[model samples]
Target: MGFSSRTFLVAPDDTLWRLSTSKFDRMLRDPASHSLPTFARQRARMASVVVELVASEPMRVMRTTYSVLAFDAEGRLDPSRFEEQQFALVESVVAPVIASSAEENNQPVVDATARFIAQGGRWTPSPALARAIDEAALEQRPCGRL
Candidate 1:
């Protein structure tokens, strides 16, 4: 039996080292937090015999399933349900077509940022990305090719 087993924990002590009635009475007088209903209610409540909840905070209940995320019957998320089908379609079809066209004609510069993204790296844009605040303001004119 495991050490956690309440039955296996409490032994008759094969010797005469039984729990003192005076000490047991003192322990009962002290404010005790309820742990084991059976052992607490019983006349003889020992440390090893009864399970004591030694925690300041309530512990989370043991989960039936190992994974934190819940899955459907098919065990996968449907892209359509999440409205991600458009993105998937663009990635599979439109993105490849545009990339091929750019590679053949434009031969676009594969800079560090582009290279990082191509290798599956991701980043969130922030106000720091804009240097317009630091740069001199352009004179107002009709928008045309430089």
Candidate 2:
């Protein structure tokens, strides 16, 4: 089995513009930038910038998708194992992003993203994850509030 994921972080407002002009996205779109060494270095730099931005801003939105494949010892498709892996991915990968966004954004944006992995595979986030995000958002009160 193999796992893969990608994450996009952007401000809620002007999402389209931000994504279009983002350095990472621009690099991806440009064919000339596809050299292995150059791409690797640029990717590292972009990731560093994202980390810094997320750490500093609460309102930035993070969009992410992950995929995994699983099979039993007999080579039978294992939906149960795949689902378990999906939940594990959410807990380990998505939870930290939610926590960061809530700490900075001051509100929870409950937009459900449908995740499809390989053929005939689908994963939806758990309700508990949503609730935790909401709670985190609520913890950030107004400046003057008690």
Error of 1 at 66 (Å): 26
After superposition, candidate 1 runs with Cα above 4 Å error: 1-81, 109-146
TM per candidate comes to 0.18, 0.21
Cα lDDT over the full model 1: 0.26
Clash pairs, candidate 1, are none
lDDT of each: 0.26, 0.32
In model 1, the worst 10-residue window by lDDT is 62-71
Candidates' RMSD to native: 30.4, 19.5
Estimate the TM-score for candidate 2: 0.21
